[model samples]
Target: MFNIAYRMLGSVAEAEDVVQDAFLRWHGADQSKIATPPAWLTKVVTNLCLTRLSSARARREQYVGPWLPEPVPTADGALGPLETVEQRELVSLGVLVVLERLTPPERAVFVLREAFGHQHREIAEILDIDEAHSRQLHSRARRHVADARKRFPADRARHEEIVRRFLDATLRGDVKGLEQFLADDVVSWADGGGKVTAARRPIVGKAKVLRYMLGFQRRPELKEISAEIAEINGQPAWVLSWNHMTAVFVAEMEGERVAALRAILNPDKLRAVTNWRPV
Candidate 1:
């Protein structure tokens, strides 16, 4: 349920709240009257998420800067199985951000069909819609995310190696080394949620991104904050903390180069994964 809600809502706090609400509802309901427990609970959670998404979309309209998905720790498989590249991609921050382009129904259908391998008929049941509509929603959602999706390393060891090397290069201000790892049109987004300072807009282009990286590395405040690599959102990411600032850098890969770098600096978003020990 947490996995479904997290993927649906792109929020750890909200997903947890939705699960708790579902539990409360389940506890209050008469089990004897329920036909199927799993299906019943899934429907409840999915509907609850739809309600939240409606309001969340409104709030995000007024959000400061680019609103990125909350990064979650997946090293322990807490959310669900992430054994396949497709599974991990579905839960990635970049893909989640792209999913925001979809309507609530479309997002729900996509997550159910793609992440959970639910047939359109089952998805229709969960969302209280017909099979035809479910198929249409899934098709639309796939089109929206098709261009946004990027390939990433399936091997944890190789992924970690790239992340660590990227971190090392960035910290040392090795522009040449870092440039080699970035895609031609690479972009970076930072989500501080207005609580801390961050780039209000996405930094795009390889050269521009390199300049930003070099400039950010020169900050005196970051000197005391050592970077730690951890498995976040089913991939290795850089977790940096010093005083009140906490940020997670998730690299979206296209083959061997990073296609995008998501910097989640919002204090609220980091709570779930902040305590994660380095992998």
Candidate 2:
């Protein structure tokens, strides 16, 4: 239930709330009326997420900065079973960003069919739409995601090695060394939610990203920060803590290099992650 809601809304708090609402509804309903508990619960949860997405989109439109998805510690499979690279990518920071472009129904159809492997008939029943409409929605959603999705290495070991080296270079302030690991057109986005200082727009190009990262590292307030590499969304990410702020830096990899970087600095988004232990 959480995995479905998380993928649909891209907010852990919202997902949990939606799931709780579903539980309350289930408790009130007569147990004998539900022909299939899993299907009934899924339908309730999916509809709840669809309703939340409508309000969530409006909230994001008025959001202070780039509205990145809430980063969660997935090493414990808290978000669900990510047994395949495709499954993991569906919940990745970049893909979740792409999903924000989709409409509520489109996002629901896509997540249900792609992430959960539900047939069009099942998706249609869940969303209360026709099978033909479900197929159409899935097609459009798939194209939107496929076109924007970054290619990541399937080998977790290699991905971890790259992140370690990248973190080491970052801590040492080795700009030139770090440049070797970045793609030429790499872009970086920071979501501060107006609670802290962050880039209002994405930093584009390798040189620009390098400069921004170096400047961020030199911030006086962040000088005493603690940093570690941890698994987030099935990939190794840099988790930094300083003062009362916790930030997660996740890289979108293309082979051995990073094509993009997503930094989640919003206190609201990082609240659940502050005490998360690395796997």
Candidate 3:
């Protein structure tokens, strides 16, 4: 339940709060009347998460720049240990961003069904909706996400290989090689939330992305910008650091090339990564 909340809210502290609240509600209720304690607890927690998601969306609308999800490390920073394929996909910044397009309930339904393997009946009960309605919402959510995310059925190994090549190009400042690996329609989005210096608008097209990457390499302020391999959302990603500040950058791959790149530089958004030390 804590893990579920963490994934949904992208904040460990907030997840803990939601879990605690669920437990409190359980404690306040009569045990004899509940047939399934686990389900009841999940219901309470999911509802709390829904409320959090609602407020979070409102806040993000007023956010200074683009907004990205917080990145989480695997138990040992090794992707192999993260067992579930669905869990791995959920961590992808691209998938998370697409999830933001979903309404709160729709997102909750999708996560519960896709990540936890809950049936429609179970989801309906958790969300306090009819089973048929739950099914409809889930279907609608899946379609919308599918339309936005073209990198479905992720290939972890292929993604890792591409990321390694990208890292090599970045380290060597090979602008041409980097551009060759990006999709023509490639888009790079940075979320700094007005707190850090980042691209105020989305860098569109392969050419623009190439320019941005090269500019960063040439910038005096970014001279110290270095990248280290990190497991974000269960996929191999790069953690960008300049001096003491750090940001997580993850790519969404389409076939062998990167379709989109998400650079999360917002300090407020990086809270999840700050507490996650590689084991």
Candidate 4:
């Protein structure tokens, strides 16, 4: 249930609130009146998310800079065991950002169909719409995400190796080494949520990204921070802590090159990862 809410809302704090609210409503309801517990709970949580989405969309619109989904560590199986490439891809920061462009109904339909594996008919029942409408919503959501999606590498060993090399090269400001793993069109986005110093806009292109990496490595502040690797959102990411603030860096891969790099430096978003020990 928390997993469903997390995927729908993209904020751990909000999802926890939704789950608590659902429980309160469930406890007050007439038990005998509820026909199926699972369906009843799902409907309650999903609708709660839909209501939140109306406002969430507005918040993102006014967000200071490039907004990103809160990266949750998958080591605890909190987001469930994402064992398949498709499942991991769906939870990734890049894909979640794309899903943000979707309408509330479209997102709900997509999450139900792809993440939870619900049939069109079941999805319709959950959303309180006809089966045909469910299919339409799912189709639209898929089309919205299809163009931006990048499938996760099928082999875990190779994926880790690439990230390791990239991290090593990046820490040392090795441009040639960085180019080996990054694509020419690679883009980087940092989200500080207006609370800290960060790039106000996306930094695009391999050259610009490498410059940014090199510049960051030369920062006097880097000396105070400790860096370690963690599996976040089902992929390898760097967790850096300095001045009591946590930030994460992850590369969204496309075969041998990195399609994107996400730096989640938002103080609020870093809360979940701050205490997480690497797996």
TM-score for all predictions? 0.95, 0.96, 0.90, 0.96
Cα miss at 51, model 2 (Å)?
0.8
Residue pairs clashing, model 3: 91-233
Q: Which ten residues in a row have the lowest lDDT in candidate 2?
A: 270-279
Backbone clashes for every candidate come to 0, 0, 1, 0
Higher-TM-score candidate among 1 and 2? Answer: 2
What is every candidate's alpha-carbon RMSD to the true fold?
1.7, 1.7, 2.6, 1.6
For model 3, the superposed segments whose C-alpha errors exceed 4 Å read 75-81, 147-149, 221-226
Evaluate model 4: give its TM-score.
0.96
Error of 3 at 235 (Å): 0.9
The model with the greatest lDDT is 1
Model 4 lDDT tens row, 179-204: 78779999999999999888989999
Q: Candidate 4: which pairs clash?
A: none
The 10-residue segment of model 4 with minimum total lDDT is 270-279
lDDT of 2: 0.88
The order of the candidates by TM-score, greatest first, is 4, 2, 1, 3
Off by over 4 Å in 2: 277-279
